[model samples]
Target: DAGITQSPRHKVTETGTPVTLRCHQTENHRYMYWYRQDPGHGLRLIHYSYGVKDTDKGEVSDGYSVSRSKTEDFLLTLESATSSQTSVYFCAIRSAGGESRNEQYFGPGTRLTVT
Candidate 1:
Protein backbone atom coordinates (compact mmCIF):
# COMPACT_ATOMS: atom_id res chain seq x y z
CA ASP A 1 0.00 0.00 0.00
CA ALA A 2 2.90 2.48 0.30
CA GLY A 3 1.34 5.94 0.26
CA ILE A 4 2.01 8.85 2.63
CA THR A 5 3.07 12.45 2.27
CA GLN A 6 3.58 15.66 4.21
CA SER A 7 2.97 19.26 3.18
CA PRO A 8 4.82 22.55 3.37
CA ARG A 9 8.11 20.82 2.63
CA HIS A 10 9.52 23.91 4.30
CA LYS A 11 8.08 26.44 6.72
CA VAL A 12 9.18 29.54 8.58
CA THR A 13 7.38 30.02 11.86
CA GLU A 14 7.42 32.67 14.50
CA THR A 15 7.84 32.04 18.18
CA GLY A 16 4.61 32.10 20.15
CA THR A 17 2.56 31.80 17.00
CA PRO A 18 0.57 28.92 15.64
CA VAL A 19 1.25 26.63 12.71
CA THR A 20 -0.29 23.54 11.26
CA LEU A 21 1.23 20.80 9.14
CA ARG A 22 -0.67 18.30 7.08
CA CYS A 23 -0.01 14.60 6.49
CA HIS A 24 -1.83 12.57 3.92
CA GLN A 25 -1.86 8.90 3.08
CA THR A 26 -3.56 6.92 0.37
CA GLU A 27 -2.62 3.47 1.68
CA ASN A 28 -5.71 3.27 3.89
CA HIS A 29 -3.50 1.75 6.54
CA ARG A 30 -4.54 1.78 10.18
CA TYR A 31 -1.47 3.33 11.76
CA MET A 32 0.01 6.78 11.17
CA TYR A 33 2.66 8.73 13.06
CA TRP A 34 3.96 12.30 13.26
CA TYR A 35 7.54 12.75 14.36
CA ARG A 36 10.05 15.52 14.61
CA GLN A 37 13.73 14.89 13.91
CA ASP A 38 16.66 16.79 15.34
CA PRO A 39 20.34 16.28 15.49
CA GLY A 40 21.54 13.61 17.90
CA HIS A 41 18.03 12.59 18.80
CA GLY A 42 15.49 9.97 17.97
CA LEU A 43 12.42 10.48 15.83
CA ARG A 44 10.30 11.74 18.71
CA LEU A 45 6.71 10.88 18.06
CA ILE A 46 4.39 13.83 18.41
CA HIS A 47 1.21 11.83 18.08
CA TYR A 48 -0.49 9.04 16.16
CA SER A 49 -3.89 7.64 15.37
CA TYR A 50 -5.01 4.06 15.05
CA GLY A 51 -8.37 4.85 13.44
CA VAL A 52 -10.63 7.72 12.59
CA LYS A 53 -11.22 9.67 15.79
CA ASP A 54 -9.14 7.14 17.70
CA THR A 55 -6.13 9.14 18.72
CA ASP A 56 -3.44 9.07 21.38
CA LYS A 57 -0.70 11.31 22.60
CA GLY A 58 2.95 10.47 22.34
CA GLU A 59 6.18 11.07 24.26
CA VAL A 60 6.77 14.55 22.82
CA SER A 61 3.21 15.76 22.65
CA ASP A 62 3.79 18.99 24.48
CA GLY A 63 2.90 22.19 22.57
CA TYR A 64 1.52 20.00 19.83
CA SER A 65 -1.80 18.39 19.09
CA VAL A 66 -3.18 16.16 16.33
CA SER A 67 -6.45 15.22 14.72
CA ARG A 68 -7.56 12.51 12.35
CA SER A 69 -11.21 12.71 11.38
CA LYS A 70 -10.66 11.05 8.01
CA THR A 71 -8.65 8.03 6.96
CA GLU A 72 -6.38 9.95 4.61
CA ASP A 73 -5.54 13.06 6.56
CA PHE A 74 -3.69 13.75 9.80
CA LEU A 75 -3.15 17.28 10.98
CA LEU A 76 -0.68 18.51 13.56
CA THR A 77 -1.19 21.95 15.03
CA LEU A 78 1.32 23.80 17.08
CA GLU A 79 -0.51 25.97 19.51
CA SER A 80 2.48 28.09 20.31
CA ALA A 81 5.56 27.69 18.28
CA THR A 82 8.92 28.06 19.95
CA SER A 83 12.48 28.16 18.81
CA SER A 84 12.79 24.67 20.13
CA GLN A 85 10.12 23.48 17.76
CA THR A 86 12.28 24.24 14.77
CA SER A 87 13.11 20.91 13.18
CA VAL A 88 12.20 18.47 10.46
CA TYR A 89 8.81 16.78 10.60
CA PHE A 90 8.10 13.44 8.98
CA CYS A 91 4.88 11.55 8.42
CA ALA A 92 4.88 7.77 8.42
CA ILE A 93 2.43 4.95 7.84
CA ARG A 94 2.84 1.32 8.84
CA SER A 95 0.68 -1.66 8.07
CA ALA A 96 -1.66 -2.99 10.77
CA GLY A 97 0.29 -6.12 11.69
CA GLY A 98 3.21 -5.96 14.07
CA GLU A 99 4.72 -8.87 12.20
CA SER A 100 5.04 -6.65 9.18
CA ARG A 101 7.27 -4.33 11.23
CA ASN A 102 7.87 -2.20 8.18
CA GLU A 103 10.27 0.63 8.59
CA GLN A 104 8.58 3.99 8.57
CA TYR A 105 8.42 5.55 5.12
CA PHE A 106 9.24 9.23 5.45
CA GLY A 107 8.13 12.23 3.45
CA PRO A 108 10.66 14.52 1.83
CA GLY A 109 10.24 16.25 5.20
CA THR A 110 9.02 19.63 6.35
CA ARG A 111 11.83 21.78 7.66
CA LEU A 112 10.39 24.25 10.15
CA THR A 113 12.18 27.29 11.35
CA VAL A 114 11.01 29.19 14.39
CA THR A 115 12.33 32.67 15.01
Candidate 2:
Protein backbone atom coordinates (compact mmCIF):
# COMPACT_ATOMS: atom_id res chain seq x y z
CA ASP A 1 0.00 0.00 0.00
CA ALA A 2 1.03 3.60 -0.47
CA GLY A 3 2.60 5.18 2.59
CA ILE A 4 1.52 8.77 2.88
CA THR A 5 -1.03 10.87 4.74
CA GLN A 6 -2.40 14.36 5.32
CA SER A 7 -4.34 16.11 8.09
CA PRO A 8 -7.50 18.23 8.20
CA ARG A 9 -9.42 16.51 5.46
CA HIS A 10 -11.20 19.82 5.25
CA LYS A 11 -10.77 23.37 6.53
CA VAL A 12 -12.24 26.84 6.16
CA THR A 13 -10.62 30.14 7.07
CA GLU A 14 -10.93 33.85 6.46
CA THR A 15 -8.76 35.81 4.10
CA GLY A 16 -5.58 37.48 5.32
CA THR A 17 -5.02 34.83 7.99
CA PRO A 18 -2.55 32.07 8.50
CA VAL A 19 -3.13 28.32 8.21
CA THR A 20 -1.19 25.14 8.60
CA LEU A 21 -1.67 21.62 7.26
CA ARG A 22 0.19 18.44 8.07
CA CYS A 23 1.45 15.35 6.31
CA HIS A 24 2.67 12.11 7.80
CA GLN A 25 4.17 8.98 6.39
CA THR A 26 4.55 5.51 7.81
CA GLU A 27 7.33 4.42 5.48
CA ASN A 28 10.83 5.74 5.94
CA HIS A 29 11.10 7.40 2.56
CA ARG A 30 13.55 10.12 1.67
CA TYR A 31 11.55 12.35 -0.65
CA MET A 32 8.38 14.18 0.36
CA TYR A 33 6.45 16.83 -1.48
CA TRP A 34 3.43 19.05 -0.90
CA TYR A 35 1.23 20.01 -3.83
CA ARG A 36 -2.01 21.79 -4.46
CA GLN A 37 -4.58 20.45 -6.91
CA ASP A 38 -6.90 22.93 -8.45
CA PRO A 39 -9.39 22.86 -11.31
CA GLY A 40 -8.01 23.14 -14.86
CA HIS A 41 -4.37 23.02 -13.84
CA GLY A 42 -2.66 19.84 -12.79
CA LEU A 43 -1.09 19.16 -9.41
CA ARG A 44 1.31 21.96 -8.55
CA LEU A 45 4.03 21.59 -5.98
CA ILE A 46 4.36 24.16 -3.26
CA HIS A 47 7.40 22.70 -1.58
CA TYR A 48 9.37 19.54 -1.05
CA SER A 49 12.09 18.06 1.13
CA TYR A 50 14.90 15.73 0.29
CA GLY A 51 15.76 14.93 3.91
CA VAL A 52 14.97 15.94 7.42
CA LYS A 53 15.39 19.72 7.88
CA ASP A 54 16.27 20.12 4.20
CA THR A 55 13.45 21.68 2.23
CA ASP A 56 12.93 23.66 -0.95
CA LYS A 57 10.18 25.51 -2.74
CA GLY A 58 8.29 24.18 -5.76
CA GLU A 59 6.36 25.47 -8.74
CA VAL A 60 3.61 27.26 -6.86
CA SER A 61 5.76 28.49 -4.01
CA ASP A 62 4.31 31.91 -3.36
CA GLY A 63 2.37 32.56 -0.15
CA TYR A 64 3.22 29.10 1.11
CA SER A 65 6.00 27.44 3.04
CA VAL A 66 6.95 23.99 4.30
CA SER A 67 9.10 22.22 6.86
CA ARG A 68 10.29 18.69 7.43
CA SER A 69 12.07 17.95 10.67
CA LYS A 70 11.64 14.18 10.64
CA THR A 71 11.38 11.38 8.15
CA GLU A 72 7.72 10.82 8.86
CA ASP A 73 6.38 14.32 9.08
CA PHE A 74 6.07 17.40 6.91
CA LEU A 75 4.22 20.61 7.52
CA LEU A 76 2.88 23.34 5.23
CA THR A 77 2.10 26.83 6.38
CA LEU A 78 0.46 29.73 4.62
CA GLU A 79 1.74 33.11 5.72
CA SER A 80 -1.54 34.74 4.85
CA ALA A 81 -4.59 32.94 3.66
CA THR A 82 -5.92 34.11 0.32
CA SER A 83 -8.88 33.15 -1.79
CA SER A 84 -6.45 32.16 -4.48
CA GLN A 85 -4.94 29.63 -2.11
CA THR A 86 -8.24 27.89 -1.59
CA SER A 87 -7.83 24.48 -3.07
CA VAL A 88 -7.25 20.86 -2.31
CA TYR A 89 -3.79 20.09 -1.08
CA PHE A 90 -2.13 16.73 -1.36
CA CYS A 91 0.93 15.28 0.30
CA ALA A 92 2.97 12.81 -1.68
CA ILE A 93 6.15 10.82 -1.34
CA ARG A 94 8.72 9.03 -3.41
CA SER A 95 10.20 6.14 -1.54
CA ALA A 96 13.93 5.84 -1.07
CA GLY A 97 14.66 2.15 -0.60
CA GLY A 98 13.66 -1.41 -1.42
CA GLU A 99 12.30 -0.60 -4.84
CA SER A 100 9.85 1.99 -3.56
CA ARG A 101 11.47 5.21 -4.73
CA ASN A 102 10.25 5.36 -8.29
CA GLU A 103 6.53 5.61 -7.80
CA GLN A 104 4.67 8.62 -6.42
CA TYR A 105 1.98 8.07 -3.81
CA PHE A 106 -0.50 10.66 -2.66
CA GLY A 107 -2.43 11.32 0.52
CA PRO A 108 -6.23 11.36 0.55
CA GLY A 109 -6.15 15.18 0.27
CA THR A 110 -6.95 18.30 2.29
CA ARG A 111 -9.60 20.77 1.15
CA LEU A 112 -8.87 24.32 2.28
CA THR A 113 -11.17 27.25 1.70
CA VAL A 114 -10.31 30.88 2.26
CA THR A 115 -13.21 33.26 2.27
Candidate 3:
Protein backbone atom coordinates (compact mmCIF):
# COMPACT_ATOMS: atom_id res chain seq x y z
CA ASP A 1 0.00 0.00 0.00
CA ALA A 2 2.48 2.63 1.07
CA GLY A 3 1.95 5.55 -1.25
CA ILE A 4 0.43 3.52 -4.06
CA THR A 5 -3.25 2.82 -4.57
CA GLN A 6 -5.12 0.49 -6.89
CA SER A 7 -8.76 0.80 -7.88
CA PRO A 8 -11.40 -1.92 -8.00
CA ARG A 9 -9.62 -4.18 -5.51
CA HIS A 10 -11.78 -7.01 -6.84
CA LYS A 11 -13.49 -7.40 -10.16
CA VAL A 12 -15.68 -10.02 -11.85
CA THR A 13 -16.49 -9.87 -15.52
CA GLU A 14 -17.44 -12.08 -18.42
CA THR A 15 -15.30 -13.10 -21.37
CA GLY A 16 -15.00 -10.80 -24.38
CA THR A 17 -15.57 -7.70 -22.26
CA PRO A 18 -13.18 -4.89 -21.53
CA VAL A 19 -11.59 -4.01 -18.23
CA THR A 20 -9.52 -1.17 -16.91
CA LEU A 21 -7.53 -1.02 -13.71
CA ARG A 22 -6.03 2.10 -12.21
CA CYS A 23 -2.95 2.82 -10.14
CA HIS A 24 -2.41 6.03 -8.27
CA GLN A 25 0.69 7.02 -6.36
CA THR A 26 1.43 9.80 -3.94
CA GLU A 27 5.22 9.35 -3.79
CA ASN A 28 5.84 10.90 -7.19
CA HIS A 29 8.01 8.05 -8.40
CA ARG A 30 9.40 8.24 -11.92
CA TYR A 31 8.84 4.63 -12.88
CA MET A 32 5.49 2.85 -12.73
CA TYR A 33 4.80 -0.70 -13.79
CA TRP A 34 1.94 -3.16 -14.20
CA TYR A 35 2.26 -6.88 -13.56
CA ARG A 36 0.04 -9.93 -13.50
CA GLN A 37 0.38 -12.94 -11.23
CA ASP A 38 -1.03 -16.40 -11.78
CA PRO A 39 -0.67 -19.78 -10.09
CA GLY A 40 2.48 -20.98 -11.89
CA HIS A 41 3.41 -18.11 -14.15
CA GLY A 42 4.63 -16.03 -11.22
CA LEU A 43 4.70 -12.31 -11.97
CA ARG A 44 4.98 -11.01 -15.51
CA LEU A 45 5.39 -7.39 -16.51
CA ILE A 46 2.62 -6.24 -18.76
CA HIS A 47 3.74 -2.66 -19.33
CA TYR A 48 5.64 0.24 -17.77
CA SER A 49 5.98 3.98 -17.97
CA TYR A 50 9.11 5.96 -17.35
CA GLY A 51 7.41 9.32 -17.63
CA VAL A 52 4.19 10.97 -18.63
CA LYS A 53 2.91 9.54 -21.90
CA ASP A 54 6.09 7.49 -22.24
CA THR A 55 5.46 3.80 -21.93
CA ASP A 56 6.84 0.55 -23.31
CA LYS A 57 5.41 -2.90 -23.77
CA GLY A 58 6.84 -5.80 -21.85
CA GLU A 59 7.08 -9.56 -22.51
CA VAL A 60 3.39 -10.15 -21.74
CA SER A 61 2.01 -7.04 -23.46
CA ASP A 62 0.02 -8.88 -26.10
CA GLY A 63 -3.40 -8.24 -24.58
CA TYR A 64 -2.62 -5.31 -22.32
CA SER A 65 -2.13 -1.58 -22.67
CA VAL A 66 -0.85 1.09 -20.28
CA SER A 67 -1.00 4.85 -20.02
CA ARG A 68 0.44 7.50 -17.73
CA SER A 69 -0.83 11.03 -17.90
CA LYS A 70 0.67 12.47 -14.75
CA THR A 71 3.40 11.73 -12.27
CA GLU A 72 0.94 10.15 -9.88
CA ASP A 73 -1.26 7.95 -12.04
CA PHE A 74 -0.93 4.91 -14.27
CA LEU A 75 -3.67 3.02 -16.00
CA LEU A 76 -3.81 -0.54 -17.33
CA THR A 77 -6.48 -1.68 -19.72
CA LEU A 78 -7.41 -5.07 -21.11
CA GLU A 79 -8.74 -4.86 -24.62
CA SER A 80 -10.77 -8.03 -24.38
CA ALA A 81 -11.10 -9.92 -21.14
CA THR A 82 -10.42 -13.64 -21.31
CA SER A 83 -10.08 -16.56 -18.95
CA SER A 84 -6.36 -16.65 -19.51
CA GLN A 85 -6.14 -13.03 -18.36
CA THR A 86 -7.93 -13.74 -15.12
CA SER A 87 -5.32 -13.12 -12.47
CA VAL A 88 -4.21 -10.77 -9.75
CA TYR A 89 -2.83 -7.54 -11.12
CA PHE A 90 -0.32 -5.45 -9.27
CA CYS A 91 1.06 -1.97 -9.65
CA ALA A 92 4.62 -1.17 -8.67
CA ILE A 93 6.65 1.98 -8.37
CA ARG A 94 10.37 2.55 -8.36
CA SER A 95 11.74 5.64 -6.74
CA ALA A 96 14.11 7.66 -8.85
CA GLY A 97 15.84 9.52 -6.05
CA GLY A 98 16.81 8.11 -2.69
CA GLU A 99 18.62 5.17 -1.10
CA SER A 100 16.02 2.80 -2.52
CA ARG A 101 16.19 4.30 -6.00
CA ASN A 102 15.79 1.06 -7.92
CA GLU A 103 13.79 -0.79 -5.33
CA GLN A 104 10.24 -1.32 -6.47
CA TYR A 105 7.31 -1.09 -4.07
CA PHE A 106 4.08 -2.81 -5.04
CA GLY A 107 0.47 -1.91 -4.44
CA PRO A 108 -2.11 -4.10 -2.72
CA GLY A 109 -3.26 -5.60 -6.04
CA THR A 110 -6.46 -6.15 -8.00
CA ARG A 111 -8.05 -9.54 -8.40
CA LEU A 112 -9.83 -9.99 -11.69
CA THR A 113 -12.00 -12.99 -12.54
CA VAL A 114 -13.40 -13.67 -15.96
CA THR A 115 -16.21 -16.16 -16.35
Best first by lDDT, ranked: 3, 2, 1
lDDT of candidate 1 over 1-115, digit per residue (tens): 3677789889998899999999999888778889999999978988998899888998899999999999999899999999999999998887755676655676667999999
Under the 3 Å rule for N, CA and C atoms, how many clashes does model 3 have?
Answer: 0
- What do the candidate models score in CA lDDT, each in turn? 0.87, 0.91, 0.92
- Residue-level lDDT tens digits of model 3 in 1-115: 4599999999999999999999999988889999999988999999999999999998899988888989899999998998999999999998766775568899999999999
Mark the regions of model 3 whose C-alpha exceeds 4 Å error after superposition: 97-101
Off by over 4 Å in 1: 97-103
Per-residue accuracy of model 2 over 3-111 as CA lDDT, tens digit each: 6778999999999999999999998888999999998998999999999999998999999988888889999999899999999999999965467537788999999
Per-residue lDDT of 5 in model 3:
94
Candidate 2, position 85, lDDT: 95
RMSD of each: 1.7, 1.9, 1.7
Clashes counted in candidate 1 amount to 0
| Greater-lDDT candidate between 2 and 3 | 3
Whole-model lDDT, model 2: 0.91
Output the lDDT of residue 100, model 2: 52
